[model samples]
Target: MTSLTCDVAVIGAGTAGLAAERNARKHGARTLLIDPEFAGTTCATVGCMPSKLLIAAARAAHQARESDLFGIRTGPVEVDGPAVMARLRRERDRFVSATRKDFDALPEGTRIRARARFDGLAGRLSGGQARLILDDERVVTARAVVIATGSAPMVPGPFAALGDLALTNETLFDLPDLPRSLAVIGGGAIGLELAQALARLGVSVTLFDSGTRLGGVRCDRIHATLKKAMAEEMTLRLGVTPEPSKDGRAERIAWEDGEATFDRVLVAAGRPPNVAGLGLETTGLRLDDHGMPEVDPRTMQCGDAPIFMAGDANGARPVLHEASAEGAIAGRNAVAWPAVVPSRRKTPFTITFTDPPLVSIGEDPDDSAAIGSADYGNQGRARVEGRNRGLARLYAAAPDGRLIGADLFCPGADHLGHLLVWAMEAGQTATDLLTRPTYHPTLEEGLRGALRQICRAVPLELPGDSDPGQPPGL
Candidate 1:
C-alpha cells in the first residue's frame, strides 16, 4: 500500500477542483487533486463543450438546408453524423491536450486513482491502515477538505423506472444514430437547446413542460419570440405533465385534451448536486435539511472539524461556473488562511443556447420597483443581420447610475455573453456603453444601441465632454 498527504486535499477534478488546484500550486501549497476517473464531466468533455459543438454542427446543417433563403441554391443537405462526431472528437482532443496540461504539468501536484471518503482519523484504503478506519468503517481524517463535486442532469419523475431507454445530457451524445423522435421531459435550457438541435438534424422533437410557458430561463421581453421560434421547430406541450408509458416506449403525456408517444425521452428539468455517500459524517460536516453540505456564503466553508466545501455537491445553482470560481477561493482559503474565509468578485451570469441563445446577468425580473432599461428592437445591426428576432433587457441602479443586469436573446450569443459580462463587471451604465462606439455593422452595436436608449430613458452620468453622435474622443 502507498500513502501520502498534502497541505490541501481537493476532492474533485471537475471545473472548480481543477481551478482550485491551479491556484493552490501558484501559492506554493502542496496540493492533492482527486476524482473517480476522468478529470472532466458535462462542462468539459461532455456537457457544455461537446453540446456546443453539436449545436454548431446543427447550425451549419441548418444553413445548408436553408441556403435558398440566402440566394444560394443547392441540392438537399444531408448530415454526415459520423464525420461531425469525428470533428468534435478532434477538437475535444486538441482542447484537452492544451487545458489538461495546465493541471497535469503542475509541479508538486499529487493525483490519486482511488476515491477517498471521510474516515474517522484519516482517509483509509481497503486493507491498508496508516490510519485507523471508523469502528463502523465510515470515518476518515484530513487537515482540511473541500468538496468541489459538481451537479448532474435531473432525472424525470415519470421515468422513475428508467434504467435504460433514457438519455440525460451526460449520455445523449453517445448515440451512434439519432433517434427518429425525441420526447424532451423538461423545457428548461437543455431541452430547448437540444430540441432545436435535433429538429434541425431531422428528428421530430416534442418538448414537455409543466408550466404554461417553455424555456425556464427565459426573459419577459423576449420570451414570446423565443417560444414562437422554438414552437415552429418542435411540438410545444406546455402546461402539461408526462407520465411514464407502461412499456417505456414513450412518455404518456397528459395535456388539456389528449396524449401521444415518442421514440426516446430526454430528462432535462435542471441539475441536482452530486451529493451521496463519500461519508461526510466522519469529518463532522453537517448537512442542511436537503442532505447537502452547508457552507458559509462568503467563505464557502462547510463541514465541522477542519473541513470545507464548494461546488454542486453543496447545493449551489448556476453550478459549474460558480463552483469553479468558489473552488479556487475555497482551496486558497483552506491552505493559506486556514481561518476559512471565502470570497467571489462578481454576480453570476447565465445563458440558454437555443437558436438565438438567451443570456442573463443580474437581478430577477419579478423584483418590484423595476430599474430602468433599454430594449434592442430598433437597432440598425438587428435589421441588417436579419435577426430582428431577439431582445436585450438592461437594468440599472435607481438614481446613482450603475449597471445592475442585462438579459440578451439574439444571434451571436456566444460572443454576446462576453460583452455583457464585461459590462456588468465594470458597472458600466447605459451611458458608459454608448460612449464607446461599436463598428458600423455588428451585433455589438445593437448592444450599444440598447444601452443608448436605456440611458436616454433615465439618463446616467455621461463622459466628461461628449459629442452628439460619437463616443468620447472618437
Candidate 2:
C-alpha cells in the first residue's frame, strides 16, 4: 500500500477543508487534503452559487412580468426554465474548477481522492507515527489531523419517497426544469431561501417546518417582517409536522394538526455530523452523549496524539461561513510553531436572503432589553425610491453604550459588513455611528435615521395637538 506523511491532514475538500489546507500551508506546514467527491457541495458546484443564479434569473423574469407597475408594457411572460438550468450548470462548472484550483494553489499541500479512517489507537504508528487508511487501502501518517468533512441534507422521515422526485440542496441544481410547484420541507435558512426564490419564479411553493420559520433568531420582529414580505406569494406552513414522502402529483405531508399536499418535496430538514465509518474507535475518540465527537472546544483536539475535528463534523453551526472560518482557525493553530490551539469566535452575522432580507448578530434575543430598535415605513429616500418597510435594531451594552448587535430589515444589509464587524469587535457605540458619513438619498442614510429613532423613543406631539382623524378644522 502507498504511504505518506504530512504536518496536517484535512479530510473533506469542501470550503472548510480547502480553507484549512490554505491556512496550514500559509503557516508553513505541509498539509494533505482529501475528499471522496471531486466537486464540493454547496459553496462549490451546487449549493449557494447556482441556486442564487436561479434566484436572480427568476427575479428578473418576475420584474419583467410586472413592468406595468413601471408604466412600461412587455409581451406576455413565459419563463424559460430549461435555459435557466443551463446557465446554472455553466456557472456551477466554473465554481467547481475554482475550488479545485484553490487546492492546487496551496504549496506543500497534497490532494487525495479518498475517504480516510483511523486504523489503531496506539496513538503511535508501527513506525512510531500516527496512521490512517484510505478507502483504497493507502496509508497516511500525519502529525495533526483536521476533519473538515462538512455536512449534507438529512433525509426526511419518509425515506421511500426520495426515489426520484425528492431533491436536497446537493441535487437541486441538477434539475433541468423548475417544478411547476415546489414543497420545501424545512423552515430553516435553506428551506426559506429556496422557497422564496422558487415562489418568486412563479412556482407555487409551500414551506413546511416542525418549528417556526427563522427559529431561534434573536428578534421576533425580524421574523415578522420576513413573514409579511414573504406572504406576498407562497404558502407558509408553520409549526407543521410533515408526512412520509410518497409517490403522487401532490406529496401528502401530515402535521400534528392536519395534512397538506405539495408537488415536489425538497427536504432540507437538518444535517448530522459525517462521522459514520470514520474509525474513531481506533483513535480512542469517544462520541459524546449527543453522539458527536467529544473534543476540547478551543482546540478541537479529539483523543490521542493527532486527530482533530473542524467544520460541521465537529458539531459546530452547520453554516458554510462558520465552517470555513473555523477550519482556517483550527488548521493554522494546529500547526503553529509548537501548535497553539485557537478559540472559536462568535458567529458574526447571518442573513435570510428573502425580500428585504433578515439579519441577526451578537446578543441572543434573551438579552433583548439591551436591544433597541427603529423602523422606517415612509422616509424621504424610501418615498423617492418608492420603497418602504425597513427596520434596524441595535443591541448595545447598557453601561458603555457599545453596540453588541444590529439587526437590519432594510435593503443591502449584507454590505454593512465592515461597520457591523467594527461594532462587535471594537465595542463601538450607537453614537459613534454618527461620525460615519452617509450619502444622501441612499439606503444607508436610513441607518442614521434608525439610530436616532432607536436612541430616542419619546412621543412627539402632533401639529395643533390633533389626533388628525378628528377633523382638522373642528
Candidate 3:
C-alpha cells in the first residue's frame, strides 16, 4: 500500500473543497485534495450556472409572449426545445472547462483521484492525526482534515422506484430535450425556478409541495402575492404529498384528490450532507441525529478536534457564497490547529430566481420589530412596466428604527435585496436610508416608500416627518 503524508487533507474537489485546499496552501500548509471525480464546482457544472442559463432562455420566451402588454404586437413565440437544450449544454460545458483549467494549474502531487474513507483503526494509533484510506488501498495521514464532500440530491422512495422517470437538479439539465409535461415535487427554490422556467418554455408544469409555503418565504402577505402570481402561470398543488408511479412509459403523480401523468417527475425535496460513507463513527466525535458532527459555525471545527466540516457537507448554508466562506474558515483554521480563530459570518442573504423573484435578507422579523410594507401594485415604475404585482416588507427594531431585515416579492427584488442587506450590515437605520436620494419612477422608490412607513412606526427623533419638506414633529 502506498503512503502519503500532508499537513491538511481535503476531501472532495467541489466549491468548498477547492477553497479549503487553496486557503490551506496559502497559509503555508502542505495539502492534498482528494476526489474520485475531478468535475468542477456544483455551481459551474450543475447547480447555479446551468440553471441560470436555462432560466435566461425561459425569460426570453416569456418576454416575447408578454410583449403585447407593452402595446407591441408580436407574432407567436415558438420554443425550440432541442435548440434550447443545446445552448444550455454548450454554455454549461464552457463554465466547467474554465474550472477544470484551475484544477490543472495546481502543483503536481496536490490532487488525489480516489475516494477516501476514515481508517477507523488508525485513529487510535496516529496520535492526533487523521488517517484516510483511499479506494486503491493507499493510506493518507494528515495533521488535520477538512470534510467538504458536498451533498447529493435526495430522492424519496416513491420517486426512486420510477427509475429514469425521476430527475433531480444533477440530472435535470442533461435531458435530450425539454419534456412535454413535468411534475415538480417540492416548492423550494429549485422546484420553483425550474417549474416556472419550463412552464414559460411551453411545458405543462404542475408543482406540488407538502407544505403550503413556497421558496421558504415566511411572510404571509409576500407568500400570498407569490402564490397568486405563480398560480396564473401554472398548476400548484400545495399542502399535498405526491405519490409517483409508472404509467406505461410516462410517470404519474397522484395526491389524495387528483392525479396527472407527465414525461418526467422532478424531485426537489432536499439535499442532505454526504457524511454516511466517511466513517464518522471512527472519528470519536459526537454526531447529531442526522449523523452530522457538532460543528462550530464560527470556527468550522468539530468540537476540540483537528477535524473541520464546511460548506454543503456541514449543511449549514448550501448557497455558493456561504460554502466558499465556510471553506475558507475551515482551511485557515486547519492550518492553525489548536490556535484556531473564529470568523465573523456575513449577514444572511438568499434569493429565489423565480419571476418577480423572492428575496430574504438578515434575520426574519420578530413580533417586537416594527413592520413596514409597500404594495407594488401602486408603484409607478412597476405599473408602467406591466409587472405591478407583488409586495415588499421591511422590518426595523423599535425605538432605534435600525434596519433588521426585509422580505421582497416584487420587481427588481434581487437588486433591492442586496441594497437592503448592505445598509443593514453598515448599521444604517430605516430613517437614515430615507434621507438618501431615491430617483423618481424607479423600483427603488418602492423601497423608499417602505422605509418611510417604517420611520412612521418606529420612535425616531427625526428633524421632521419621514418624508422631506413636511412639517416638523408631525
Candidate 4:
C-alpha cells in the first residue's frame, strides 16, 4: 500500500469540502481533498441548479397559459416534456463540466478520487495523528482532518423495495422522461417544489404529506394561503400517512383518506448524514443519537480530537451557505490546532422558490412577539403586475421594538427575505428601519407598511396637538 502525508485532509468534494480545502491551503497547510465524485457540487448537480432549470421552464409555460388574465390572449400553450428534459440535461451538464474544470485546475495530485475511512485510534501514526485508509489501498496520515462527507436522501424500507421505481432528489434529475402521473411523498422543500413544478407541466401530481401543514409554514394564515394556492394548481393531501406498494411497472400508494396509482413515486424524505463506513470509533470521538460526531457548531470541532465535522455531516444547518460557513470554521480550526477560535454565524434565512415564493428569516413569529403586518391585495406594484395575493408579517421584541423575525408569503419574497436577514444581522430596530427611504409603487413599500405599524405600536413621543411646531395633520 502507498503511503502519503498531509497537514490536513478534507473528505468530500462538495461545497463544504471544497471550502475547507481551499481555506486550509490558504493557511499554508498541505491539504488533501478526497471524494469518489469530483466537483459537481450538490447545488449545481442535483439539488438546486437542475431543479431551478425545471422550475424556470414550468414558470414560462404557466405564464403563457395565464396571459389571458392580463387581457393578453395567448393560444393554447403546450409543454414538450422531452425537450424540457433535454434542455435541463444540456444546461446541467455544462454546469457540472465547469465545476470539474475548476477542480482540475487546482494543484496537481491535491485531489484524490477515492472513498476514505478513519484508521482508528489503535492505528495512529508516530505523531499521534489519525490515519485514513483509501479504497485503493493507499494510507494517508494527517495532523488535522475535516469530515465533510455531506448527506444522502433517506429512503424508508418500504420505498427501498420499489428499487428503480422510486425516485429521490439524487435520482429525479436523471430521469429519461417525465412520468404521466406522479406521487410525491413528503412536503418539504424538495417535495413541494418538484410537485408544483410537475403539476404546472401538465403532470397529474398527487402530493402526500404526513404533516399537518404544507412546506413547513408554521404561520396559520400563510399556511392556509399557500395550501389554497397549491390546491388550485394540483391535488394536495396533507396530514396523510402513506402505504406504498409496487405493482410491476406501476406503483400504488394508499393514504388513510384515499388511494391512488401513480406512474412513478418520488420520495422527498429528509437526508441522513453520510457517516456510515467512516469508522467513527477510530477517530476517538463519541457519536450523537443520529450517529454523527458530537461537535460544537461554533467551532466545528469534535470532542478533544484533531477531527472536525462540517457541512451536512454535522447536521447543524443543511443549507449550502451555512455549510460553507461551517467549512471555513473547520478549515481554520484544523490549522490552528489546540487553540480553536469560534466563528460568528450568519442570520438564519430560508426561501422556497415557488410562485409567490415562501420565506422565513431569523426567529419564527410567535405569540410573545409584537406583530406588524401588511397585505399585498392593495399594493400598487402588485396590482399593476396582476399578481397581488399574499401577506408580510414582521415580528419585533415587545420590550425594545427590535426587529427579530419575519414570515412572508408574497410576490418578491426572495428579495424581502434577504433585506430582513441583513436587518437582523445589523441589529436594526423597527424605528431605524422606518428611517430608510422607500420608493413609491414598489413591493418594498409593502415592507415599509409593516414597519410603519411597528413604529405606531411603539410609544414614540410625537408632537402634541397643542404644540405650535406640530404640523396641521399631526
Best by TM-score: 3
Off by over 4 Å in 2: 106-109, 124-129, 248-250, 256-260, 295-297, 303-305, 343-347, 365-369, 453-474
Instruction: For model 1, state the Cα shift of residue 385 in Å.
Output: 2.9
lDDT (CA) per prediction: 0.67, 0.70, 0.89, 0.84
lDDT by residue for model 4 (1-474), tens: 799999899999888898899888999989999999785788888888899999999899998998898899989998888899999989999988887775986798898999999987542333468789999999999988999999999998998999898999888888877899999998888888898998889999988888878878868888888888888888888888888999889999998878889999999988888999998876767776766777888889898788889998887788899888989899988998767898888877888888888988876656667778878766778878888888888888776778888888899999988988898888887777666666666788777667767766764332334423211221
Candidates 1 and 4 compared by lDDT, better number: 4
Number of the candidate with higher lDDT, 2 or 3: 3
Tens-digit lDDT track of model 2 for 1-474: 888888888888877787788888888888888888757645767677877787788778877776776688998888878888888899888877877777666554387889998776453433244577999989988777788877667885474455766888878888888888777878777777788888877788887777875634556787787777777777777877777556465576677777766667888787678887777766756667655667665666664346667778876566677777778877876686234665857646777666566677775644433555556566456545445676777666554556677777666666654467666786666556656566666656666644544344322221232212211111
Arrange candidates by lDDT, highest first: which order?
A: 3, 4, 2, 1
Per-model TM-score on C-alpha atoms: 0.86, 0.88, 0.96, 0.94
Best by lDDT: 3
Number of backbone-clashing residue pairs for each candidate, in the order shown? 10, 3, 0, 1
lDDT score for residue 362 of model 4: 79
Kindly indicate the candidate among 1 and 3 with the higher lDDT.
Answer: 3
- The segments of candidate 1 whose C-alpha lies over 4 angstroms from its true place after superposition are 1-4, 39-41, 93-103, 106-109, 120-140, 157-160, 246-256, 303-305, 317-320, 365-378, 461-474
Per-residue lDDT of candidate 1, residues 262-363 (tens digit): 677888887877666666655445666766666776777663334566776666555467877777887777675446554655666777888788777776
Error of 1 at 229 (Å): 1.7
CA RMSD per model (angstroms): 4.8, 5.3, 2.6, 3.5
